[model samples]
Target: DFFIEFSRQGPCILSRSILQLLYLPLFNKVFGTLNFADVLKDAAKNFIFPPVLMPKSTLLLNPQAKEYVDTFLTHCVRPFGNLVQLCGHNRARQRDKLAHLLEDFATLQDEGEWKTIEEKPPPSSPGRDSNLDLPVLSSLAQHDKRVSQLRHGGGGLDVDSYHRTGEAQCQRAERVDAYLHNLSLKSDSPRPHLACFGTWILYHTLRVMIMYLLSGFELELYSNHEYHYIFWYLYEFLYGWLVSALSRADSFLTEQEAMAEIHKGRGTKKNKSKKKKTRPYGREITIYQALQNICGGFYKVHIM
Candidate 1:
């Protein structure tokens, strides 16, 4: 009851007709003699309190109701609805549970029941076609190449290729190093337009790195001599990456707003009166840039 009340009065919704079509029968069975839709309608009578008695913005438990509503609708509900309609009952979604489904496959050998008819290739020389040519992830060598590209301002990458011999010259870069490398490549592509998500992931990855490194200082984990290298790393990598990510996100938001304005100009004037709001990432870029400047100052002082 509390949950229903919360959701009804909270920051989100479903149309009554669709709701009736979907949930009314099940609810009627549970309600027995009672009228369910009438009960719901009655509960919603005070869903919006009169302006004289209470303002529409009066928050209950959540202070940031608008933000939460936007996130849930944009990030959760819309994606889920699109996915359900596009890929209904997809068997590929069950790939992660293969171990449990193995019993369903026809038995080929005493060791195991399998789906594929071809003989398994040798462990040392695994066939590329064995896995059905599903999307492969960027390799360490690819990561190195991407990081090199990002580092050198998107020019030709000069990094040595990773080979299976001789001291493994291609040292694995950090996870953020690997991820940020892909942003430049994806920015120009049309299909997977996930720059916003990419920026968010980069922020989180960089945050984790900064927090872990900061925690080491609090715990006295490093020797005095190691401080130089630690601070140097902070000045060079963590702060710079965070600022770059914020700038990318900020620019993307700007482009999106410009497109929205163009649409608005094309006759959609419903939201014309609403003033432009500052995006959170713009403030974040300013904050991180200031922090980077401070880090640079400290690094210079250490050199003196």
Candidate 2:
């Protein structure tokens, strides 16, 4: 009960109080005396004669449940997802536990007792063949949402959707390669419109980031319910992804130092001894603790 109460009220009270800590100079700087006795007296009085709850705020507890709620996200991630990323070149270092698990499952699925073969369409009906090509997600609401978002949104991601039989890691890499081949053309023709990247590696890096958002983010946090604004801001997530994407682009193009030109203007010189230019942000940093502050504490405190 205490834990529940703490989860409810802690966030509402702490959010406002934490902001006050930033402005503490307002009260302390002007005053000369640090009256320890008076501070203790006031605290006792307030506890005995507690005021009415504020419009949307509740009274926080002394033995506050802050710490428990604060760490709930870490708890959720261990069993479900640890926010790992997918890297094609360095598989072991980059892949998280969840990624490995899914890939393993995909592998077992290929060697399964039950086989689900896609049905062929009637030769007379061309439309039936096209319908077979249409993407189908599980009945789970989350999958439905991701598919809808992917269809409307960009960067070629349908996160919750399953892959064909293989290692999930290899499948992801294949998709990234396919995306570059189709989208990252050098010159624009009267052909279909595609999103092009400066270098082939840059496109792969972007795909990694997108895959992280799709897979890693899903692993860490649950989005089955309503709004998730408190957990992760869409703009911030994409913005951070872009930053990491560019960093990877710089490393791949400059350090690898291949003579092959990425574009007419872009340089592709080799550097035999290129130093690590900058510290690269890991996939976990951008998404970790995104929901820690808000998830469990959403209903911790109650109005009394």
Candidate 3:
């Protein structure tokens, strides 16, 4: 009963006091301090006089009084940037957790069951046949030929071909050195594309910071529904906008890189043979057509 009354009247009383403070100038000008203090004293007198409904024992042993006092103190208390510092600390913790989770997921992928299927066996076949099975055999032969052609002529592995397992540490160090050297030359060379890429990275970092702060607060202060809603709303808006902006930035960068490559004449070669041989029926009819022709040629064999 005491808790119910406190819950109902506590917020109302606090709200009225806040409104009165806001109109302090008008009250002071019109009624002066004497009338103001008298009104204030009367209000304070209500606290001294226990409620008729409130039991004497319950009034003396107020369970919610401490909470109310803490609430009042929290509202009145002023700190020099403490809230900002607290928020920063929470964001940092969240960032650390997110980083750790990503690292763990990567490690799990590297050590997972999918590694077992890295080796695959060649297809097997039984006995060979004569001219009767020529069409079927020819189709199988064509499929094999196509597979071999792709394996031998496909754009050869670039990164994996250069990657060395035993010397990975040494290779990584060399790559880092080269990267730093290129980065140092950027000021003189002025690669606008790389600058934009760096800016995009920074933008993503800020987005992560915002996400981290919101998630951290939601997890820690689950009871603060209003704060949770505000944080989530801000996070969703910022995240969506950042994602859209990043997508546009990525597309723009891709176009710039493509144009740069074109200017340098550094794109994949156009296969004239592939262009000419696109429509296969022009070159030679498929085995399926040949089989149908043979079947039609020997309708008597089908009857037998």
lDDT of 3 at 221: 36
Model 1: worst 10 consecutive residues (lDDT sum): 106-115
| lDDT by residue for model 3 (140-178), tens | 112222221111224221222222221232332232223
lDDT tens digits, residues 65-139, model 2?
Answer: 223212321222221221211111122233343233333332222221111112122111111111111121121
**Local distance difference test, per candidate?**
0.36, 0.28, 0.30
lDDT winner, 2 or 3: 3
Candidate 1 Cα misplacement greater than 4 A, ranges: 1-194, 268-279
Clashes of each: 0, 7, 0
- Could you tell me the TM-score of candidate 2? 0.19
Predict model 1's lDDT versus the native: 0.36
Better of 1 and 2 by TM-score: 1
Instruction: Estimate the TM-score for candidate 3.
Output: 0.24
TM-score of each: 0.38, 0.19, 0.24
* lDDT, residue 126, candidate 3: 16
> Which regions of candidate 3 fall more than 4 Å away from where they truly are?
1-198, 264-304
True-vs-predicted CA distance for residue 177, candidate 1, Å: 17
